[model samples]
Target: MSKALTSFLGENLADLKDKGLYNIIDPVEGPNGPIIKIGGRELINLSSNNYLGLATDSRLKEVGKQAIDQYGVGAGAVRTINGTMDVHLKLEETIATFKGTEAAIAYQSGFNCNMAAISAVMDKHDAILSDELNHASIIDGCRLSKAKIIRFNHSDMEDLRKKAKEAKESGLYNKLMVITDGVFSMDGDIAKLPEIVEIAEEFDLITYVDDAHGSGVLGKGAGTVKHFGLSDKVDFQIGTLSKAIGVVGGYVAGKSDLIDWLKVRSRPFLFSTALTPADVVACTRAIELLMESTELHDRLWENGNYLKAGLKALGFDIGVSETPITPCIIGDEKLTQTFSQRLNEEGVYAKSIVFPTVPKGTGRVRNMPTAAHTKDMLDQAISIYEKVGKELGILA
Candidate 1:
């Protein structure tokens, strides 16, 4: 390494430390679930994205083990070369059916899916109207597309309409697309998809919704598109198997042509190795479970509601969240970090989110109550929150 580069990195690292923005990773000692062990202590985990608590489910593990026994552990090569397995096709088919689309394609991760799909269609000649609060994957994908990115205020239909009109009127682009997250992760807010679809229709723009956090949460586990009954109207529905599905991989559900085009053009799909057979099988089984019954989803909602009610009752400022994601807004970054630290010390595993992940001075500790969390667990978390809030002067 160059000495100059090393010096620059050292300076930047020191700056982060000085500002109390440097984070030290805390390792989870066991399986991630509703409750997790960290640093030899078990805590009620409200920081995980495993919405349905499927990450540690024994059923998924059995399916994964069976696939491994049958097909081994790896895909061996990229899909375009020789890696496409029967399980991959089956998973895609399952995703298509779940999203009510003609076809679907899977990628290594949700982030890779966005990076691949957005650039596959939209290019330098195209313009993309994107939500300001879209996931980082979407932002990176838009950048990779080399398109003119027009940002609209988060969930602001009027701003989206204004930007859409401007982009359409300029005639400076060959294609126009609007993209947003189906459910924002930080604030746990649902996107205004119905209004967005109406705007897309008026502007003749292709619509895309990344439902990474929505799948297995909204629409009885079908997703936000299905939740809003706009499955047939949205052009692209992106989802992940990592969170609620308790597996790994990302997929894009859309018309057959779009899937076909992505298979041929998406660099990640063409060059990166496909998902392992076990992952594909486990993901398929997870979807099957979701379709079979709404028990898990309903339980998740109950847990979410319980936690939200408990938090609000404790006099914490829970933001305007319409989903299982509840945020305790603490404002200052240092205080938010301290709050999270105290929660962990008190046997509650809620993580603090500060600037860059969220807006400045709006730092919060996001709580994700999964289906596996019992009422007693939530009650304990609320008690801990109250204690921490009082000690820190956050609550009267």
Candidate 2:
């Protein structure tokens, strides 16, 4: 390694640590489930993104293993070459059906999907009006596309409309697009897609929604687009198989032509190796389960409500979260980190969210309640939260 590169990285790491922005990742001793073991102690897990608990579902594990036995562990080449396997095609078809779209295309992950799809469709001539709170992947994708990115206020309709009008009237760009997360993960607030659709119609702008967090948890597993009944209206519906679906891949569900174009032009699909056989099959099975029953979905909401109620009752500032993604706003970065550490020391495992992720002075401990968590587990976590909050003077 070059000495200059090493020194640069070392300096940055020190700065991050000094600023309380560095994260210490915990290694789970076993499967990430309702209760997780780390540092030899089992704790009620609230930090995982395994929304539906399919990450450790016996059915998915069985199917994945069977798939690995049938097909090798890897997809040999890029999809454009020989990597496009039967399993991949099947997964795409399943995603299309699940998303209620005419066609769908899968990628290795949600970040790659965004990087691939955005640049494939939009160019430097196009301007993208994005939500300010959009995921980091969106920001990178917009940069990669070289599109003129105009950020609108978080879920603010007036700001979006004003920017849309300006972009259209400026005539400096040949085309325009609007992108947003279907559910803002940090805040758990659902995007205002209905109004956004109306705005898009008014401006003839291409609309894209990354529904990574909403899949399997919204619209009976169809996602936020279907939750709002704008399946036909929205142009690009991006989803991750990893989050609520509890597998490993991302996809874009849209009209057949749009998917067809992406399959040919998307760089990640053409350059990167396709998802492995086992991951594809496992994701497909997860989607099938989601479509079959709402048991897990109901449980997830129930647990979210339970936890939210508990935190609110304890006088912790639980932000306005419309979904199961909960954030206990602590305001101070050090306090937030200390709170999360205290929770781990006790019997809970919610992670801290601080600067660069959220605005300064709004540090928080984010909690993700999955379907696997029992009521007793939630109750215990709440009691721990109460204890920690009172001790820290965060609660009265």
Candidate 3:
């Protein structure tokens, strides 16, 4: 490699390590359920996004195996080419039904969906009003669109309204779009979508919501838009089949025209290989399960509440999370990392999240309590937290 490239990598790597910003990944030895094995050690997992625990469900596994037997493993081509199979159509149809939209289009992944959808519709002549704390995919998508991105304060409705009005009234752009995450991943706060939709209507702006973390956990398993009764108002409803659906891929549910446009115009849909047959079938079954029953959804909230109550009672700074996601806030990056490491050492596996994933001085060990986590597991996790917190001087 060139000396210039080597020098740049060396300096950045050392800087991250010295500052405790570098992440160390541990491979899981088994299924990503409430309990997981890492390096042959069993630990209560509070770090996975398998909110419903369907990733290892027998029913899903059966269908996936059957699909592989029938359709083979791969889709073999891009959607616009020969890759759009009957199973792919069924998945999209299921997504549209679950999301309460006229139509839907699937992509290779949630991140790719944003990259495809935003740039396909908006361009340099457009302006996008985005939440300052939206996922990185949204940020990159807006950049790819070459649109003028105006960031409003995180979950601050007044700031969003002010920015929306200014952008709409300025007449500098031909189209105005407002985008935000239905649930902020780090803090677990729900977006002010009701107010955002109100503002969007007043300004004739296109509304886009990426409910990657909210689907299957809210709206009786439909999603955040339907939870707020604004499914008809939002122009784009983006979601992932991975997080709550317990599979892989992403999609956009909207009017038939938008879906049609994406099928042809979205670069990812046109250029990238379609989702694997097994993934598509498993995702479809997962959505069906969510729509059929709220057993998993209710259980997820129960476990979440149980865990939150336990942590809050122990005098830890659990942030303002409205969903099942729980974040134990630790102010210093090194201390936060140490807290997480200690937790793992003691049989809990909640990982530390620090800058630049979150703001500096606001590092946290984010916990995701899933339906599969029983009260016993949560109680044990709480006990471990107390031990770690006291040892780390984070609790009284």
Identify the leading candidate in terms of lDDT: 3
Per-residue alpha-carbon lDDT of candidate 1 for residues 1-396, written as tens digits (9 for 90 to 100): 999999999999998666657677889998999889998999999999899988998999999999999999998999988899999999999999998999999999999999999999999999999999999999999999999999999999999999999999998999999999999999999999999999999999999999999999999999999999999999999988899998788999999999999999999999898899999999999999998999999999999999999899989999999999999999988899999999999999999888778888998999999999999999999999999999999999
Off by over 4 Å in 2: 1-3
In model 3, where do residues sit more than 4 Å from their true spots? none
Pairs that collide, model 1: none
Candidate lDDT values, in order: 0.94, 0.93, 0.95
Against the hidden reference, what TM-scores do the models get? 0.99, 0.98, 0.99
CA displacement after TM-score superposition, residue 267 of candidate 2 (Å): 0.8
What does the lDDT read for residue 318 in candidate 2? 81
Q: What tens digits encode model 3's per-residue C-alpha lDDT throughout 83-172?
A: 989999999999999999999999989999899999999999999999999999999999999999999999888998899999988989
By TM-score: ranked, best first: 3, 1, 2
Error of 2 at 298 (Å): 0.9
Candidate 3 clashes between residue pairs 3 or more apart in a chain or in different chains: none
